[model samples]
Target: MRYRTQAVAYPYWVVALLLYGLQMVFGLLAIVKYLGPDPIRAVLPFDVSKAIHTNLLIVWVLTGFMGAAYWLVPEESRTELYSPRLAYWQLGLFTAAGVTAVVGYLFRWTAGNKLLEQPYPVKLAIVVVMLMFLYNVGMTIWRARRLTTTEGVLVAGLAGAAVLYLPALLEFDNYTVSIFYRWWTVHLWVEGVWEMIQGGLLAYLLIRLSGADREVMEKWLYVIVGLTFISGILGTAHHYFWIGVPAYWLPIGGIFSALEPLAFLAMAVYAYAATRRSGLAHPNRMAVHWTIGSVIYSAFGAGILGLAHTWPSVNRWTHGTMITAMHGHMAFFGAYVMIVLAVVTYAAPILFGRPHEEHETAIGLWAFWLQIAGMFGMTMAFATAGISQTYLERIIGLGYLETQQKIQVHFLMLLATGILFAAGVALYIYDFFFLVPRGHREPTPWPAAEPVEA
Candidate 1:
């Protein structure tokens, strides 16, 4: 089938890698704006840097999701995509739209929301591109030869792409409505759609890498997807707690948000048990490491820190502070970004017809550690800064600007941590693009021997 070939997946990987690199660059610029002198702020405005950071993040995640779709759709459907040409067109449109939107934001054309700041036209273009992609993927699945795996997960992710955009499209002139729509996009994408994608991709990877029965993995996939949707839809209420929504939302959001981590934990246990019992035919250490990191960080960041702010009492103090940002960065990067990277790593070797170089794998693993450590360090520093600033401003009645100056030192620490993250990204990009092995390698035959368990 045409989809069985690497050509369908190669372009997705290329775009993902490029966007990943750009995300890191923007990350560094954002850090510079936060830490560097006022002169640096003039060159790289905070709004521009923030827009770049958020937009780059969205681009990389989408790129990775596209690659995962290309890789998994063929295997699950047992058929080639209905039209690779349509996929190419989707890619072209999305790339053009993403680039144009980011440029527009940097040039000051924006909607003014923190994460949803792209210009109106750019937002419309994004919606159109998403629709095109949805149509192409939907058609491919419709014409598929089979649906042996968890089609629900795939459909859920696609549905999320559209559903999450609904609130943004709602015409409401009020800032409250704007905030509601913003969270609809933000919370649903991270806690809902991304989770579905992660579940589907993980199921596919587990089946391939662990040599586990597809049926068993598919069942686990159903459970994962079920939990994600059930929890995610209600969990969005957590963000509503401080947003001037109905007071009744607090309990609903907190309860569901608290249950969200259980899904990831279950996934971890399932992977470990499956691998241990089935005997991994291809125990890709890099992939395993990334997957494990994703679960651990998500559980801690989203589950634990998320619970910390679920209460209105706590959120009243923590909302809009660096503490919230700290939680968001770790949870999103760990849950979504790492899962995407794992899928890419798993599929890249198969598509390339060779294992990635051992050194490259090592580099990726090292980058994983660096990013986790750097993010942890930044989160701790920011949390401390946030609490201290809050107490100084609210409790001690310090001036807002004075409180900011007081926290400036902590931002310095955040900058240093960001540099470490940037270095790790550099290593990741270098290893993934320039150093990983490519093309076929001659198989090394072994003498006849007894059958091994693996």
Candidate 2:
């Protein structure tokens, strides 16, 4: 590592990987429920398993984001972190709360809100940890007085996400009121502020891997942030379609949410243009692949698939169906998850710096391709199932259970593809954690200082 204090990120990264593996475990279990005769349905119900899967995913990614911030801030500012101890403390506090919340969910001790099930106490703890984290990062930048645009956007996104979560902490007696507020935190995040976080990291990764000019890239950052806010804020109306809101939201949601994809499209173009300008000079082809892949996949998943059913007409048929699940899997995986993994892949050499034969190995490539292929297959399976269900249940007016029975075959296919996805995840975890990098090729030291001749 270039700086000793960068070691603070190591533990956070380790925690992210561990949580990632656990998340996959629960994810497989949750999906397998669709294909069963589930023997353990009583012991581990689908709801609990799915909750754990989703909750773990959120925790792990946020954990990855925290580690990325710790790693990036110091490097960007050209200063060591202000307090490694505070960073560690923040991680511990966050982990303790997360673990407790996960355990509580298994025992039916949740707030019963989808994706916001963490009890009030757990929510408070999250806030505390977030404060500590922001404090450490904010102070580090202030101490150095060398904040870069990349880091500034990232911190703003992090703080905005924290502020958005505040609404979820309170309870509402009315379902309409609750659902209305829920989207404020949920939709506004994926479509709004989190995009800033992604854009910032994307800029950082592209600049380093593509040898892109910092001034030019940050200029692109301003454009992206502008586009995200322009479209994303009003796009919250998309969720307002069926949430007991007025009919006026229908057109507003369709119009604005449709524009939301422009930001993702811009990201893809930005990454590709930057890389092409590099003339493939960077040695680490794997990092380049990840960087470019994140951009394109996010565009397809978040922009294209999201728009597929975003309109009120299409959303009416697809709402609360597997179609949403399909968009969700691809959108979340391609957009947020891949970018986090991209950062890890790019930083792995630094984190576990080793003079290996190739920093980007064939096994790593296999893992990446396998995941992409498997997720595509899964998405197709869901699409087919959702289409059939919509026709049978929604259009044809068949009963919900009857439609489900007719679509069991699709669940079988889902299970099959899910196995492939699981395998890819397993390989990635093994390649990253098990296969140690031995090339700690530190830069050579300069010769001893010599006295200047008079």
Candidate 3:
């Protein structure tokens, strides 16, 4: 079968492949710096590599969301994208701006605000790109008249993305005030907006893969979004403790952030329940692997480990240490990045009009397991290092510099784990792009929908 390159799935594969490649390269660079000598850090500084790592993550995930939206929206609404040309333009502009911003960060041009450090102009460019994307998606939704569960979630995410930027763009002198709202952007977007996007995409995937009832999946979507907002909005307080905020914020943040994990837990249960209720033969085994893996890992890694640091007592020791990275890496990967990858896997064969090779699916599944194992190993090593550093710095009255030196071996272990992750990523890229079944001229028949249990 000759699969059309312009199919809805093509954009997703393009974005996923590009991001995976960048992620492997920069992810390796990050690991190498910590394991290598001081001179190596000079060549590839922490700040630069961190910027590349985080931004690549953000851009690629958003690109996946875009592709998902483009594919799912039209299918659900029974209409073509309102403007493919606009989408293409948005993609081109975003790619250019993202590259420019990454380059600027690599050379030390930044706003110096941790996650929000991209320079002013770059931030402005991001905002513009987002607005353009919003316009395109919004118009598509309007023209379609028929709204799906996923469309609602996607719109909500886009709205949250727009609103989250308000505080970062505001002029503020007091770092405390700036930091407070910074979490609104960082925390809210991840816990709130990204959660919505994940929920929507997961629902769409389940509908396709499991032949699950759209109504049931839609209800799950509402519950997920409701829990996310209820828990996630107040959850922003978790970051307030160390940022010179009121002492009262500690308890509020701790309690609400603790509740945030419940949403994820519910999502995992719901996905499993729905899939089991619908007795369908999933066409893509790798999609099932990724979907189930994402939900389970998010529940354990994001929910369980995240709860460990939500309290003031535990957080007091965990803050500014490798422990936080453990949570961030696992949670983000499990909750958001994995969902995006799953969506790509689910959509790719349909977009290409071909059945993916079983061997390739098996390879991708192995790569998934390896990546998860690597992340788990790295997080454990970091947690150990963080606790050791905390004891040395706080209990033993050792200097910060001395404590870092004391945990050098743990950092080396983290570097090794990162290498494992890179290897996993390499396998994934090969399995998806190079090794997967492709280049079909005939359209494959859509799989029969199985019965859905009441």
Model 1, residue 291: what's the lDDT?
Answer: 67
By the lDDT metric, which is better: model 2 or model 3?
A: 2
Q: Candidate 3: misplaced stretches above 4 Å?
A: 1-9, 356-360, 442-454
Question: Model 2 over residues 53-171: C-alpha lDDT tens digits?
Answer: 98888888899888988988888887899999999999999999989989998998888798988988999999999899889999999999999999999888898889898889867
For residues 316-385, write the lDDT of model 1, one tens digit per residue.
7777777788788888877788888887776555555454334336677778788778888877777788
Q: Output the number of the TM-score-best candidate.
A: 2
- Which scores greater on TM-score, model 1 or model 2? 2
lDDT of candidates 1 onward, in order: 0.73, 0.84, 0.77
* Residue 346 displacement in candidate 1 (angstroms): 0.9
Off by over 4 Å in 2: 355-357, 437-454
Candidates in descending lDDT order: 2, 3, 1
Model 2 RMSD vs true structure = 4.0
Q: Say what the RMSD of model 3 is.
A: 2.7
Q: Which is the better candidate, 1 or 2, if ranked by lDDT? A: 2
RMSD of each candidate?
3.4, 4.0, 2.7
